[model samples]
Target: MTNTTPQAASAAESATAKPALIERNGIEIIAEAERTAKPRDLFWPWFAANVSVFGMSYGTWIFGFGVSFWQATLVALIGIPVSFALCGLIAIAGKRGSAPTMVLSRAAFGVHGQKVPGIVSWLTSIGWETFLAIMATLATATVFAKLGLPSGTGVLIAAAIAVAALIVVASVLGYHTIMKLQGVLTWITGAVTILYIILTIPHINMDAVMAIPAGSPQAVIGALVMVMTGFGLGWINIAADWSRYQKRSASDASIVAWNTFGGAVAPVLLVVFGLLLAGSDPALMDQISYDPIGALASILPIWVLIPFWLTAVLALVSGAVLGIYSSGLTLLSLGIKIPRPAAAAIDGVILTIGTIYVVFFAQSFIDPFQSFLITLGVPLASWAGVLIADVLTRRVDYDENALFDANGRYGAFDWISLGTLVVASVIGWGLVINQFADAASWNNWQGYLLEPLGLGGVDGPWAYSNIGVLVSLVFSFVVTLLLRRGKIRRQEAAPATDGDN
Candidate 1:
């Protein structure tokens, strides 16, 4: 006879219970039973998302700042890993709170005040996902053209629709599904990427690369800022989303280490390789500025083009999937009354629309978009600085109940944090200049204080030196550390329900 005892029946039920294919959790604290992820699992998503050949395009961007091969190499080495380490620091908040990053900011900014940065985070996520989708679609069209297939307007539209659909489907399936997908993609994409590097090695001219002259100090700093903003700071807003599932018992150091390792390893190598390729051929560098992934495929052997295109597109989609997933949670944290799947679907639709516009309608979008991102980076750096300070100052776990309760220990608004964010952003903007000639008029508002500070006007020697981004980060971090410590300590010490898993 079958086992009928209570223990045997429970065992049978447990063995048969499978996790839902679509995750339903939103911004709420994750249930203890579901917090089963390990710190090492973080490596898969970070590595997969970052392993895209597009990173090679950053070499072109760095070179545009007038830096030489060795100078750019130094910038890439320092910028990539150091920037990602910040993401690792932010991930600590996830393990402590078991909530989304924006939601956890409530302890520092209060429930209502957190919305300001939350909106910025959401917009950044949507912009990045749409950008990736557009890249994938373009990659597909380029590869099809190289194969002698008809690559017309219709083909572009079709590719966009297809890429958008893949990204949407993966994102709507949510966290657990993404984790498994990312892990598998990491290996598939990593191996193909290696093969691509081997085939392209012959194209690299070390003699020409070494012959290029070094740029000015201002240009070197600009290159460093671009590298950081492009790689790590670009994704910091969503860093914690991947870690919310980590077991509370996971070591903090291990969490940071894995997060840093997964994110930094791929880009550091790719960018250095890119430096070699771009340095050898100025024409290739120019092409990369306009079409990163597609231009990358231009140099490949026709036989490898097919696999290169496939891996390239998949890598872009993998990164977009992570963005959309976190964007969905961010939407929820904004007080949207919808299920997680629906939020992801909503962001996916927006992404599709944005991709269509960028791919089909927008004129001279690339340079302007690059300038826009750099401009936005200042405020984002300010936000990161404040949040990092809050994360480091707290001694106790985030109070789960208080995170949602404005009337509780957190209150309705923390004016000090709000003021710091605003002041830092304003000053940071003044210190920066938009070097892109094609940038929109509004972007011209920057560099107002550049003349006053004797850095020369927007067209001066320091024109492209975007030291403002660094200033914003340091200014906000120090201010918060000095002024907000007591408030953060009080919040930590206040009475609340136990949030420990």
Candidate 2:
């Protein structure tokens, strides 16, 4: 992919300036050097992002359903690939449109109307950032305790603050810094990940672990949703934010394959390690923490604990940085009109407070994390459905300038696209049932589609198989296509009416 297409428009500027690594590309067309990433470059960035306890706990969650290690690993093996592929697929928009995913959506949702999804995407990014911060803080505190320091409220709060602040600093440095950090840390984290798997091999009891029964079909389905929702759908909103840096000539297939494989490496391997740890021991659930580092300490030697703990903390911080950076982009995409770095700083501040509360105050991780992922999946998946359909059907032949102009051809509001997003989100909400969450946690779930509506019988299957996301994807796609068909008809008719006059 030679981006030899001559720097978007400004040839002279492309030759003179090396592109500001920290500026905003949220609402503007990505000019020259900013479009420097290749398809292969995406491999490590994604690898570093997925290598964390944030995703590890999801693997550990499978044991809560009483699935065997082998069975749990099977579910993960199936789900992780499916989810990561979506990341690759969604990333194509970054290259094709020469903009962030949220900016590209302006072609779908209209300039002003996009604020709705933009806000949702913003919250999604912030939610991820905040959640990752909480995990990192707790992980660090747990590690400190293992090292014979305080893991009490004071220590937890301090760790949370420190981790959140560091992430913010990295994030405010913007795109290149995050990628560079990830590139370098990918090696450290990758080594620790390998060491983790190696240590776990010495403890594996294949006979007993394999004997753990696969649960009922309903339960299996629920576990599938848990793994897929936690890993896959959670990433949909931010796919383009990272991929937009890929040169325009980057291979679509390479982008998808690299993203799928690279992103899958750490999560799948770590989750497998987690599932095995749980399935091998009956007392596993008793030791499970929101941060899985403590749980690892219980099984591995104390000598192995510190490096694993420290690396886990670092990976979690990296994950949060990705979220912080993208949340800032989404904020700008919402038409905030602020400098990108400033937007990132503002998000960092909020994340700091959120991290403190979740780590020190809330003192609970699994419930919130599970519910958060389920809640985020619906709207994002539905939104992806719209864009996927548009790309496939050629509905995405957009005018780059018109995307930003409120009075231009795309307009300030596109009721058809906006309405599709709304309806799809509603359906996504309804069918989504938090499989891992208790009834109390269920009440707070965004995917709590059935309870408030008061439909018991219908809720059972809907919650079990959870077809809401599927329905949202297909429904939005079909609806958007129909709307485009109608819009084109009207446009053609207007020309005839003028001719008649």
Candidate 3:
């Protein structure tokens, strides 16, 4: 040891050091795999999880509302292809880059602009997670009350315990674990729901369903659109959260197709079941509105009802878990230095707070909670639109090194992306805000402008708010094209320099 030279000693130390498997910026990526190892994801499990998450888009409420089930079915069937294409285009960008949605947003927004969307996603998810927790509690209580525990305080307590457990379980695992759980939950929940639909079908009043009139001709169109647009807007904004775990080699288009298809179509059966029950027994519908549990219990056998209730509760937990995990990823992508577990903890806490709000004081907070999500659609759509433009312009390729290089191609303020996002969001949001301002607001406006629509006058923005989602997408793409033209012109205008320089 005394005779060893400094060079030899240094070499020995180097030889003993463990090689780092992955690096990002200055961060080590050791949780899952080595840098060279392609992402290992539970493909089918993840796929089923996504489908389940998407199914919640049209779960219970649409059925409970007692609208035309066919309208919802049509909306889901048609909207799936369109929404899937948009989600697929954005997802492909994330897939090719091996980046999450927020990380990819950095290419379009400056690192500064990146945070706006990140916070938006984070805050929105917190509210949603809370809503899910509350809904789960409500659903659990409803199920128990139906089972003869009319007071349901015990049911509520049990539901709270269950929700806490789900958080703990979801917290301990990583993406692989979550995906597997979600897959099993989806099948169980989906099967139970489908069975409920089959059983409930015989109870529907076909004559009343036919005579329902959709609440005037115009209202019918509006309700129909609402059903379609509602397909997955609530949580679909975070599709990338789960999809990011998907192996890059998987055909993303297929995932999007299935995701959109499952999300859009599966709930229609549930709605049909609900509608049949509502149509056949209007008195039962009215009674259960105040006591939803009692209403459902009467329709379902004790065995059928218990599993159905459990399925709904599990589904709620599933949505909350996905939201929390995705929010954590978005935080990480934005350069938060916390450990993944710590990040997830922050989400759980936020969700817990939201759950409290829902469980103890739901009626007051619930309306605004839903409105907030409706408002979020514009911005989420805008970001999604920019993502599509960025991908299409680059011909579906991004240099991996550029993501780390400060002065690299992906760096910089993409004015086109930013500007397009802002403008589109404003225009789309205007559609929502104007609908409420005044009837005079619409009367004096340009005749050519489309009026905001809603569901049978039950909700505002009677038509599909998804129009905002669609418009934001189209406008962002068009603006990106305009900016691209300007970029090309400016590049040609400048004098040439040496390639190395």
Candidate 4:
């Protein structure tokens, strides 16, 4: 009805063609007003994104490790919120700098110092992508076997590759698409989980749940630490990766609240579910040690189980996509010259092979998954401390262009951040390894450190509730503050921010 000029028509077409969020390629500074999202718009996407089997496996650890129901619940209560608290804070950090989370760390660590966190972030992303991909693939292969399809190593690897392909597609599409799918998945996963809860309810045993038989303090504490490690420290690294797209006007408190609630809800509920099922049948519980999927699958009917199976497949994609997407952004943080989609594709290929190897070739898949959690807890925890402290102290004022330019103000490296990581990592690892040696099984993952150091003993005070990570966090925080405060004073004394400053 109305005539439009050619210039106006072209502009309209360009606007329509653009993605709701995530610019072309993967990691670049997001310009303001580009795909701005609100706080509530932020919540469900994150919440549903986490409604996967990974949380189930993590929660299963609480019961598998012999923690009582109430004890497991307490740890879940404390640990999930604690981890998400860091996540929420970091999510707010997402707003301050329009770059990915790791990129923002450059401000605190300096240009050169940024590489340390970048490398760690990339490795974690790739590791998780491979791990979840393998787990989800194997779960799907099991379903394949049930459908009269021949199942074996070959079939398993094939299924894994299929899932890997999906991850690549989603990650290549980038942030907004992933979040949109997550919104749909929230309903899908919730429906399946609700059905699971219904069947599981009749079997709930009050005696088992309330039953607190004889247990030593050492074992109890160890269980709590492991539980916290499972749900909390494990996820703190990537919290801000999702929240960086929020509208600049989004309130920090609102972001923190929604992020915390969204992140905490599913894991806590699922862990309690695992605790209940532990009471119903102890034998099925043992299967968790070997096959977490099969063990849980054994609980539901074959018909109702389809939805659950689909959840695993979708969950794997959701989880892996998170890693792949972040890995792309992380590559950019490395100052790599590659485009975002290419970076993500490269990550996807490596993970595809890794997933196949871990599924078919590795002696076992679960141990590595378990070991990485505690092993990573130390360094990531330390980084979290330094990162959050820097953010709060500086009030999230960042100079973006300088972050990429080595010669720019942030400097090639900050000796303080690097030095803090080294010292904190050593201390934190020692505390964690000592705990491992204390609880050393036949194939102790930490045995390499314990035997050489001769630190063998029973559980120590630091072993309880991931105090090792806590110690690393507190130590890093204090050291960063003291170091940064002096640097600020020196900067005031001199106009230029020299290496000393």
TM-score of 3: 0.75
Tens-digit lDDT track for model 2 on 1-501? Answer: 111223344664445465466654455666655677889888877889888645555655787765666677887898788878877877887777677778777766777887888887888888877877776776777677777877888888778778888898898888878888999989998898777777767766677677877776555656766776667567777787878778877888998999898888778877887776666665654567445666665666778888887788888888888888888878877767687788889999999888777666675766766666667667777787777665555533345566566665556887888888888888777777665455336533444556555534334533555556667777987887777766634432432111110
Candidate 2 residue runs with Cα over 4 Å from true position: 1-12, 19-21, 24-26, 66-70, 395-397, 434-462, 481-501
Give the lDDT ranking, best first: 1, 2, 4, 3
Residue 357 displacement in candidate 4 (angstroms): 0.3
Write down the lDDT of every candidate, Cα atoms only: 0.88, 0.72, 0.55, 0.69
lDDT (Cα, tens digit) per residue for candidate 3, span 341-395: 6777777776766666556655444335434655666677777666666666664
Write the residue-wise lDDT of candidate 4 on 217-240 in tens digits. 544555666765555455566777
Q: In model 4, which range of ten residues has the least summed lDDT?
A: 1-10
User: What's model 4's lDDT at 301?
Assistant: 67
lDDT of 4: 0.69
Better of 1 and 4 by lDDT: 1
Of 3 and 4, which scores higher on lDDT? 4
How does candidate 2 score on lDDT?
Answer: 0.72
Per-prediction tally of clashes: 0, 0, 7, 2
Which portions of model 1 miss their true places by more than 4 Å? 1-17, 497-501
TM-score of each: 0.95, 0.88, 0.75, 0.87
